[model samples]
Target: MKKEYKIGLSIIGLLLLVFTFTDMNISNAVYNPESKFGLIFEAIGEFPSAIIATFCTVSLMLTREKDKSIKYNLGTVGYIVLLIFFSLMASMIPVKYLHGPKALIPILMAIYITVSYVIAKKCATTHKEELRRAAIVGILTFIFVIIAFNSIKFLWGRERYRHMIEVGSFAGHSMWFIPQGFASGNEFMSFPSGHSANAAIMAWITLIPTFVTSLKDKKSWFIRFAILWTLLVPVSRIVVGAHFASDVTMGVTITLVIFTLLKNKYINNLEEKDAIHMFI
Candidate 1:
C-alpha cells in the first residue's frame, strides 16, 4: 500500500474509534432542529452523483482508441443538464409530500447503474479492458458496501437518534453504549448509516477514473468535490434524524476501507502500462 493511503486509513480508523466512545454527545450536538444548517446540507448532498456516474462511465468508453470523445463528452454534458433540471423540479415538491428521500435516491442510483452498465457493455466491443475493469469495480463496490452496511446493521440492532429516550421513544437505550445481545429485535437499525455508505460509494465511483488517469495529475477540484460530498451526506443524515454521529462515522470508514482494498486489488491486476500503484 502507498504511504498516503495507509495514513488516510489510519486517520479514519482513529476517528471511528473516538466517535464510538462519544456517539451520544455528538449526536445530541447536531440533533436539534434549530441547527438549520443540516437542512441545507441534506437538500444538496446527493445532488450530482448520478451525473458523476454518467461521466465516469462515459470516460471509460472513450478509451485510447476510437475517436468518440466528442460524442461522449457531449452526452455527459447533456446528462448533467438533465440532472440539474430534474433536481430543480424535484425540489418544487415538498419534503412532506414525497415518500422518502433515502428510498427514492437509491432507486435513481439503480437506474443510473443500469444505464451505465448498458453503455459500457456496448462500448466494450472496442474498449474492452477499460470498460470492463471500471464496470467490475463499480458493481463490486456497490454490492460489497451495501451488504457490509446492512449486515452490520442487522446484527448490531442499534436504535436511531430520535428513537432513543434522549429524544423520545417508549423503549430506548443509550446511543453511545454497545452491549451484548444487542443483535436483534430492534425496529430502528441505526448503528451504521446507509446514506453515508452511498456517499462513500459515490466518492469511490468518481475516484476510479481519477486514480486511473495519473497519480501526479490528481485534480484538486475533483478531490475537494468528492470529499465535500462524502462529508456532507453522512453529516446530513445524522442531523436529519436518520442516524447518529457514530453510525455515519463507522459507515463512511467501512465503505472507504472496502473501496480502497478493492481499488488496490484492481490496480495490482492491471498491466504495467496501466499500473497506478507503482507510482503511488
Candidate 2:
C-alpha cells in the first residue's frame, strides 16, 4: 500500500507539471459550453457523489458490535436499516418541498443525528461505542474531505474551464503555472475541481470501514461502486464549464493520496488498538 501510494503521488505530480505547462492548449480542445454531450454529463455526474455519501453514512451507522451476541446485533442492525430506509425515502422527496436542495442538508443532519442517537439509545443500548464510532467515521470522512479540498483550493489558485480566453473570459488561459497573485483572481483559482475532490473523498470514505472487516463480498461491491463514482464525478466536472480535464484528474488524484494517507495513519491505528483490546 505504501509503495502504491508513493507511485500514485509521483504520477499525479508529473501530470500536474505537464498540465501546468500546457493548460491553455489542452483546455481549448474541449471548452465548449454549448455542447450537448458536455451538458448531459454535467447534469448526471453529481448523482454518483450523492450516492457514495449515502452509502458511507449507512455503512457507518450499521457497524458490527464486537461484544454483542449475533442475534441481538442482527436485531439492532435491522432497526438501523429501517432508519436508513426512511431517511433515504425522505431524501427522495422533492428538494423544493424541503425548501431547497441546500435546505435538505440540515434536514439530513438532523435525521442522521436523531436516528443515530435513537439507535444508540434504544436498539443497541449496550453497544454505544460501536454506534459512536460509526457516526464519527461518517462525519469525519465528510469533514476531512471538505477541509482537504478547500485547503488546497485556497492555496493553489487555477482558473476554471469557462474562465479561459476561448470561453470569452478576458483572463487568458494561463496554465496551472500562474499562482493567484501572479494572474487575475478569476484565472488563478482552478487547478483542482472541488467537486471532483469531494467525490473522490466520499468514495474512499465508503471503503475505509471495509479495511478491517471480513465482509469481502460487501467490500468488493463497494470497491466497484467507488471506482465507477470516482470516474464519473471527474468526467461531469470537466464536461461542464466548471473544470478542465486535467483539473478534475489532478483533483481526484491528489484527494485519493490524502485520503489514503489519513486513513492508514489514523483509521488503521484505531483498528489496531481495538484489535489489541480484543486479544487482551
Candidate 3:
C-alpha cells in the first residue's frame, strides 16, 4: 500500500475504534421516530464508495500495468470469495443477507468477476505510466471519506441511538433556515446520507470506470457486468435502510463531480513525467 493510503486507513480504523467505544458509552441514546440525521449516520456505513475506496487506495500502489491489473483481479476475486463466505454466515449475522439480496448482489458479483477477468485479458502492454492516477484517485477518495465522517458526526450530533435520547436542533438553532430535525424539537441531519455518499463514491468514481476503462466496449458483455456491479454497491446501501434515496442522490452528485474533475484533469493526462507519487 502507498504511504498515504496506509495512513488514511490507519487513521480511519483508529477513529472507528474510538467511535465504537464512544457509542458504547452512549448506547442508550436511541429514540423512537429517529431524527433523520441519526438514521443517516447509522446507514452511512453501507456506502459502496466507502468499501471501494478502502480497496482502491491500497491497489494504487501498483506502478506497472501488470501489477495494477493483478492487484485489481486479486482484490476483486478475494472480495467475491469473502462475500460467499459471509453469505453462508448469514445465519449468524443478519446483515449477511444483504437487505434485498434476492439474487441481485450474487448476480452482480458474478458479473464483476467475469468482466474484470476479461479486462485483465485485454491489456496488451505492461507499461507503467509516470502519471499519479492511482495516488490521485486514492487521495481524493481519502479526503472525501474524511470529510464524510466528520460531517456525519457534526450533522448527526443529535444522534441518541444507543442512549435512546433525541434532543437538539439541526443547526443547534431555532430559525427555519437553521433547519430543525425532521420533526419538532428534533435534532439530526438526514438530508444527505453519508453511507450513500461512501458507496456511490467508489461505484461512480472508481469501480465503474475501473472496469469499463479497460473494456473493449460499453455494450460488450464485460461492460454490462461491470456496470451492474458498480450500480449494485450503492443500491445495496439503500436496500439495507442505511440511507434514503435523496442521500444517495447527493452522494452520487458529489462522486460524479469529483470523479469528472479528477478523470479529466489528471487521470486522463497521466503521462510519465517521472514525478514522485502524488498522494503526499
Candidate 4:
C-alpha cells in the first residue's frame, strides 16, 4: 500500500514537472485577455494566496491543534502551490514555451484534488455526515455568491468596469478592449471580468464546502473536479474576448477574498452546533 501510494504521488509529481516545463501559448497573451490575465494572475496569485493560507494555518496553530498533521500539510502544500503558480503565470518574462492545454489544466486539477482529498480523509468525521454537510454548505455558499455577484453586476451596471480600471479619467486609460470587457456595447457592465468572476466564485464555492467535510476522500476528489469544471466557462469567455487582464484580476481578487473569509469565519465550524443552520 505504501509503495503504491508513493508511486502514485511520484507519477503525479513527474507529470506536474513535465507540464511545468512544457511550452505555453505564451505568445497567445499578446492580445488574449484570458491568456494575459492568466499570465499576470499566475504571477501574482501566490502573494495573496500565501497570505490566505498562512492565516488559516495560524488559526490552527493558535487553537493548539492536535491530530491535525495532515490538514497542516495540505494547507502548507496549498501555500507552496500558490507561490509556484504565481511564478509560472508570468508571460512577460519572455521564455519560449510550448504546452498543451490538456497538460496545464490537469496539473491545476491535481492541486485541487490533492487539497480536497487531504482535507476530507485526514480530518475526523463520519463519512456520510461529513459529505452531507459539505454538500449543503457548498450549495448554499455558491448560491449566495452567484446572487451577490449578479447583484453587484446589476447594481454597478455600466459603471463597474470603471472601478476595474478607472477608464473615465484617461485615467480613462485604465482598460483593455481586445478582451472587450468594457461596457462599450453593453454600457451597463464593465469593472470586473464576469467570466473570471464566475470561475473564481466557483473555485471558492467548491473549496469552502469541502472545509465542511475537509476535502480528504476519494469521493471528494470527484467533487474537486466538479469545481474545476467551473474554470472552463471563464476560459471560454476570454477566448471570446469579453474580459481583459485587469478585469480578470479584479474578479479573482473579489472571489478569493470573499470565499476565503466565508470558509474560515463560518464553514470551518460546520460541525459545531447549529452552524449549518446559519446558512438559513
Candidate 5:
C-alpha cells in the first residue's frame, strides 16, 4: 500500500472508533430536517455512482472493440447492458426530490453519456489495456459496495434518526452494533447510510492515476478530492438526520475497503487475471 493510503486508512480507523461512541450525540446535535443544504445533498448523493457507472460502461465498451467501427462481442454487449442498468438506477434516485420537469432526468443522463464517451474514447485509444483494467476494477467496486452496504442495511435494520424524530421518540432507536433485522420499511434500513456509501464511490476518481499517465503525479490531488467528497456527503447525511455518525462511518468504510481491495487486485497487480475475462 502507498503511504497516503496507509495514512488515509489510519484516519478512517480513528473516525470509526470515535464515531461509534458519539454517533447518537452527533446526530442529536446536528439534526436539521428542513436544511436546504442537507436536502440538496441528499437529492444528488447518488450522482457520483451514476457518473462512475457511465464512465466504466463507456471505457469497457470502447476498449474492448478491435477497431473504431464499434463491433461489440456478446460479452461486451452484456457488460454494457448491465452497466447502463446500474447507471439508470443510480441516476433516478434523486428524481422524486428534484421537483423538476420529467425531462430533466433524460437530459442529465444524456450529458453523462456524452462526456463519458468522449473521455473513455480518449483513454481507450491511448491507454487501451490500462483503461480496460481500470473500468473492470471500477465496475466491480461499485457493484460490490452497493451489495455490501445494502445487505448490511437490510439485515441490521436500525431506524433512521429522522424517522425517530418524526415519531416523537427515540424509544425504538437501536445502536449501530445491534441487529433489529427485517423491520417495516426504508426507515429501518439505516444502520449503514446508503447515501454515504454511494457518495464514497467518488473515491473511484483516485483510480484515474492508474490509467491516465499524464495525471499520475497529481494523484494526491484526486485523493484529496475523493476524501473531501466522501466526508462531506456523510456530514450531509448526519445533518439531515438520515443517519448517525457511526452509520455514515461504516458506510464510507465499506466502499473504501472494497475499492482498495479491487484496485489492488486488478489495477496494481499486473499478473492477476481480470475477473470478468476469466469467465467471459
Candidate 6:
C-alpha cells in the first residue's frame, strides 16, 4: 500500500472512532433539513458515481474490439449490464428528488454521460493498457462499495434523524453499532450513508496519474479534491438530518478501503515495464 493511502486510512479510522461516540450529538447540533447548502447537496451528492460508472462503461466498451471470442463477448454483456444498473442507481435519487422540471434530469444525465464518454475514449485511446486496467479496478471498487454499504444499510435498519423528527418520537432511534435488521423502507436505511459512500468513490480520480502521465505531478491535487468532496458531502448529509456522523464516516471508510485494496492489487503491483507510471 502507498504511504499516502495508509495515512488516509488512518485518518478515516480515527474519525470513525471519534464519530462512534459523538454521532448523535453532532447530528443534533447540525440537523437542519431546510439549510440551502444541505438541500443542494442532497440533490447532487451522489453525482460522483455517475461519472465513475460512465468512464468505466466507456473503457470497457472500447475493449470490445480487442477480441471477438465468446468469453470476451460474454464479458461485454456483463459490462453493459453493470453500466446500465449503476447508471440508473446513481441518477435515480437526483432525478426523482430534484425540485425543477423533471425533463431536465434526463437531459442533464445525457450531457454528463456524453461528455464522460468522450473524455474516457480519448484517455483510453492514448493509454490503452493503463486505462483499461484502471477501469477494471474502478468497476470492481464501485461494485463492492455499493453492495457492501447498501447491504449494511438494509441490515442495520437504523432510522434517520429526520425520520425520527417526523415521527415525533426518539423510540426508533438506534446507535450506528446496533443492527435492527430488515429496514422496511428508505427511512430505515440510515446506519451508513449511501451518499457518503458514493462521494468517497470520487477518490478514483487520484488513479488518473497512473494513466495520464502529463498529470502525474498533479496527483496530490486530485487526492485533495477527492478527500474534500468525500468529506463535504457527508457534512451535507449530517446538516440535513439525513445521517449521523458515524453513518457517514462508516460509509466513506467502506469505499476508501475497497478502492485502496483493489487499486493496490491491480495497479500498484504491476510490473515496472508494464506502464510508464506507478500509482503511488
- lDDT for each candidate structure: 0.62, 0.59, 0.42, 0.43, 0.83, 0.82
List candidate 1 segments past 4 Å from native.
33-127, 165-171, 174-187, 207-218, 271-280
Per residue, candidate 4 scores C-alpha lDDT tens digits across 1-280 of 3575477456645643542333122113433444654554433332222222322332232233346588877766764564344333322122212333544544654554445445545432444344434443343444455456566555444333223333533223222222323244443454455545545644433444444544334556655753564454444443434443444445555565566555555546654546657776
All candidates: TM-score: 0.64, 0.63, 0.41, 0.37, 0.87, 0.88
What total of clashing residue pairs does each candidate reach?
0, 4, 25, 20, 0, 0
Ranking 2 against 5 by lDDT, winner: 5
CA lDDT, candidate 3, residue 60: 38
- Candidate 2: where are CA atoms >4 Å away? 35-134, 154-157, 165-171, 182-188, 208-215, 274-280
Steric clash pairs (candidate 6) = none
TM-score of 5: 0.87
- Model 2 scores a TM of 0.63
In Å, residue 240's CA in model 3 sits off its true spot by 6.0
Summed over model 3, clashes come to 25
> Model 5: per-residue lDDT, tens digit, 11-109?
978887887788888988988988888998888887777688778978887876564444446676787687667666655766767776666677767
Q: Write the per-residue lDDT of candidate 3 for residues 1-280, one digit (tens) a residue.
A: 4575477456645644554344323232332234454344334334334334333433333342444577778966764554444333222222343355455655554544444334333421242232235445644754665576446435543322222222332223221113333432222443344444554454333323333454324435644543454355444434433333333445544554565566555554443232344543
Residue-level lDDT of model 2, residues 1-280, one tens digit each, is: 5787688778877877887666566666666667675665455444344444454455455554446688877866764664555455335433433345765755774665465455445533544444445444544555566676666666767667676555677454555545554334644557667667766755553543344344445776777877777877676666556777677877787667666665665556777998999999
Q: For residues 229-265, could you state the per-residue lDDT of candidate 1 as single tens digits?
A: 7888888777767677778888887778877777666
Order candidates by TM-score, high to low.
Answer: 6, 5, 1, 2, 3, 4
* Candidates ranked by lDDT: 5, 6, 1, 2, 4, 3
Can you tell me which runs of candidate 4 are displaced by over 4 Å?
1-29, 32-128, 155-188, 204-236, 270-280
Residue pairs in collision within model 1: none
- Give one digit per residue, the lDDT tens place, for model 6 in 109-167: 66666776787778877887788888888888888988899899888899998998899
Comparing 1 with 4 on lDDT, the higher-scoring candidate is 1
